[model samples]
Target chain A: MAGRSVVDAGAPLRDRVAETQPSPASVIATEIKGLVARGDRDQARERFGALVAVLQRRALRVAFQYLRNPDDADEAVQDAFVKVFMHIEQYREDLSFDVWFMRILVNASLDRLKARNRQQRFIAPAPDDDERPVEQVPAAEASSERRLLARERWEQVTRAVANLPDRQRLVFTLSQVDQRTPAEIAAATGMSAATVRVHLFRALRKLRGVLGEQA
Target chain B: MNRREEPDPTLADALDAYRAAAWAEVDAHFDERALESQRQRILQKVAQAGQPARVLAFPGTTTSLRPAAGISRRWISAAAAAGLLVGLVTGQLLHVLPGDAWVHRVAPRAAQPYPSGRLTLIPAVATTDADNALLDAIDVAVTSRGASDLRAFDDLTFAYEPR
Candidate 1:
């Protein structure tokens, strides 16, 4: 009777965990948590460093777009990693640790923004270097013209993205800069998938309009 | 594309290209130097976190309270002797003071009845609520004065006959 009761309680949990194969990030996080549990803190810390290396560049990219200043972005990323290590024990084994870490990163960026007490600056679009008289570039240099136009378009797109409402900007950065999907972004930002899609659509529409107007 | 219309594939393609270009530019801006310095700072912080905090000290600077190199051991011994002598003299003076008996008397006078006087016994009665409240207040006041100070004043009382 005891054996039957134990199986009834534990079988489904084991099956469910097995059914969803853990991602690499989740696997690494679990390993770190295990090391910490066994009292091998040094090994856990080393593994955590590896995890940081894996995520740091992407985290910095997302943070930088959210906070225009490099220093603030750096601080936010560092703060996020520190928090992740401090709360590593709280990580759920079933969930993707990447998304969890990203959520912490997003909160860290917002915290830095609040701490600075500065309104998000709407950066004015700089004058296009490609806007000089078409005659300046010889008609034969088609590649150079294409490159110039691309540079011009890129600037306009960045400016438009920068001017978006903070939520839309956050959605766009996660989607575009970090290449996260709408569902993943929803998980990271604690918003519904529908909301994330709407924000992304609105952001893209604004960008398209800016480009069209420039063209 | 019309504003109300669905997003155009061409526009999406262009935006994708722009995103790539922007990422490349931003990635390049984070150059090797900046990335290395930031990484070093982060690792330094992590290493520091794992260990106990150290008080910041300048290089080659000693935090010890020892005297300078020129000061001899004889000087140190002399200073120590001086401190001990001063302490002993102070203790002696305190022992000879007029109120010294108060420090030595461990038995409170109230705890033992007045030694040489005729003792009057007040009949035991249930204390009134007002009397209990007053006693509680006194207890609190004595407790707040701390155990050592309370012991020092253990013999003192407020009970006295009006003239």
Candidate 2:
């Protein structure tokens, strides 16, 4: 159970949140909500920079894990942040803001993916640039032969993960990349806990098989 | 949600290494400077989204929208001048046509002393029987084409005039 707010009725909200489990990002979200509700949007925007700073790297990581393209990931993160600020009025303070935000980020990524699919039907895809980040990762490590082998394994794993069906990919990425639990994944994706667990098991089984094949 | 799923320690370790390796590459590429750039961009987008949309007052005629504002301006001025000239010509035609010519067309014959000192237009062929032949003649004359020349106007006779 993800209980967000524990009862501490004594201190002020901000003071109490300093040591609480609600993250700095969630606390910033709450403050921004108050600033927006009070019609102080300029101050809210000022506070929103802090929120973006707290969440930007994590958001980027989740997006890059999903998209594999840095540019698309950047765009997805930007769109999600803009949407969060635009619809800040609808946010509920009692629930976990991180979960709410991750849901928005996931939706934004899905929209970008759909748009890319439509665009690909008309334009012949270019040979993927040799300068891709995934291909460039293992070049910096110790032995030359070892680096080549490591690159091959990483490429194989990436391909295997990419080939998973959309739900499985989502479940696996949120679980593996974003470090979300089955319960959190259920909340973010609107799937039931049992469904999240089922998808998680299937994804893990397939990935393990891929690792076994490599071995 | 945060509880580590303890299904298999070896599998979890491998997956954790995988996750770590993936994020390490991310951190290598997207460094602090890159993250700051992204943060600034997100804040920029948020700021833009907060403001109300700018509405163009005259979308078509906006200077910014035009390919050649100077050329378009000259054309617009020329069009306005042409419109004004056409309007002036039409007004002049209307003014001149209704001058001495129209007065002669519908003017009364030398106002013979009306029974009262004031000018009066009396119906000529008064009838109690309700049929008005004179009115029928006037209607036909009014509806018929105007005389073809100025001489035609002079030849037009008013039946009510004294012979």
Candidate 3:
């Protein structure tokens, strides 16, 4: 009877173990929580190193479009990552971690942009030599030649985006570049859906005109 | 520039293609490895600071009685010190009494028999109640100059019935 009782207990234990396997995101969150709770410096460093390997490049790209400066954009992405780890407890399981993390990156970038703008009245435009003008180049240029052309086109696009009003720029970047839906952009930017749509429409129209002039 | 004119469809297509190309260019310029290294360094610094260990030990829990206990102990100690100060002052004042003659002047003397008047009840006046008249008489007796040695009246009890 004792052996039978022991077997019964073991069966439940095995079932419970099977029932409790964590998903990848949850596991990551749990490991982060544990590191934070234990103040485990080495583990935290490794975990963050892994997380950054996964997330940093994408975050930098997104931040750069908003901030324009490579250094500022890098700082913004780093700051956002730190904030994400620090406030991991507040992360809801229902949302995609990438979306949640990107939201932080966007907000951090925007905040830095606002602060920099307040300190300096204007964001200095990248030098004309730094920007390769797509309009000046012939379509039949060599592959190596077209690389410079691509760079110039991107520079013009960046300038056109920067010249847009703040709301329009934010909406355009979040929607057209980040691939966020209108609703997501509205939620992220604290604008109404209709307002976000209007901003997006105006931005696209302005960008079209700018590109058209160059063409 | 004309508001009423329809937008050029070819221009719209070109803009879309340009936007896509722009994002690809931005992505190509991003340095992932450098960002990862920075993130690792920040995490290392934070972990070295010991915040995670502290947070883990009391995860979701606030310091319960520990903080209140410390505050309360400080308050009690302060109160005890105040009480001791007051007691010392009182003891000193008690010990530093006046001279013997002054004590004799203040202390009661040997009792000497004296004539006393009985408290006769007066009928209630048209404007005064029985309770009020009695209270006024007692007040007058208590305030009189020779009423100092009225020991029986020291712990006087007055009883009144509701009218």
Candidate 4:
């Protein structure tokens, strides 16, 4: 009885529940289960391929954030997807599938990070070839000189954030860039709220000092 | 104790301005559609990969079960046939088979006598009879004394012939 629920591998259950009728994803998942039950490997493999295609982009982004290297990120994402497929019966429909999937991604990222740390391997950031100037606002009161200075200040802040200790850096990125709450960051990082707060405080102080010095 | 609650106007102004700036930056970065797409994709992968199915504690009605709902008569017939087959097979295998077949196939050691002169202490009184009162009393005494599986008196064969 445990680990048997109709879930669409093509889309999330939230979207399916929101639909007026049963979603195609649910139907597909049900069919996949039946195929699996009947020992129809070919059909399961085809469905699995479709599932991977649908999840690749989002998984890539999450992996990219954690691994900071495109190749490593891609590998991690693919591995996580494979793991999810292999252990599909462990999923619970009562919980949001995204949260569950993110849990997998986070765990995979942590494992990779730990392994790399053990090997003393440095993770390099992926190249952002599409980096462009901040879109300009016409009829703004601010002068071009002032805008340039602000942009420079932001750059300094970003650099300061990067230079923070790993814990501080992670807390700052999750809080500011990802807009996750302190509680959420605590949950993801497996740190106490007080610890997260301390990290945030240190990160902010370091950023202010760095940016203020640059100014 | 009621202390004077003096507002630090300078600190308040700085905090307000910082909050506004932070909000503006957050708003600039916000992408609802992107987040939704990510959520959808993650869910899809989870469902497809069967990750969600394993965590579910109970089997529920699926899309396939929905289609099967219309074939009531066929389902009844199939269920009856399956039940009959199982019942017949179980009865034949467990009870109707010959003793020799059971002894050879099921349990070869049924006729062998258990090793004698080793008394196992039963925790509670096993029977309600005046004749078994002695056994019950002995059981209580042995258990209370914490006597382990002690060997019975050697060279003495005691047999109880039931009436």
For residues A133-167, write the lDDT of model 1, one tens digit per residue.
Answer: 33332233368767566566666676788789988
Kept native contacts, fraction for each prediction: 0.19, 0.43, 0.28, 0.03
State candidate 1's DockQ. Answer: 0.10
DockQ values, each candidate: 0.10, 0.25, 0.12, 0.02
Which order, best to worst by DockQ?
2, 3, 1, 4
For every model in order, what is the number of clashing pairs?
Answer: 0, 0, 7, 16
Candidate 1 ranges beyond 4 A from true positions: A1-21, A118-142, B1-7, B32-37, B50-52, B55-163
Q: What is the C-alpha lDDT profile of model 4 across B1-163, one tens digit per residue?
A: 0001214343223223332333334333324554344445544554465334556534466655755776876899999999999999988787877755554564444434445444443323223353267577667867763454342542245755689
**What's the C-alpha lDDT at position A165 in model 3?**
92
Candidate achieving higher lDDT, 1 or 2: 2
**For model 1, what is the alpha-carbon lDDT of residue B27?**
63
Regions of model 3 farther than 4 Å from truth:
A1-45, A118-152, B1-33, B48-163
How well does candidate 2 match the true structure in TM-score terms?
0.65
Better of 3 and 4 by lDDT: 3
lDDT of 1: 0.68
Q: Write model 3 residue lDDT over B22-55, tens digit each, in one string.
A: 5555555554565556676656655554454544
Query: Which candidate's DockQ is highest?
Result: 2
Question: Chain A: TM-score in each candidate?
Answer: 0.78, 0.83, 0.68, 0.55
Question: Looking at model 4 chain B, which ten-residue stretch has the lowest summed lDDT?
Answer: B1-10
lDDT of 1 at B16: 64
Which lDDT tens digits does candidate 2 get at residues B19-108? 766777677768899988988888888878857998877766675667687788999999999999999998787678954554454345
lDDT of 3 at A13: 25
- Model 1, residue A51: C-alpha shift (Å): 1.2
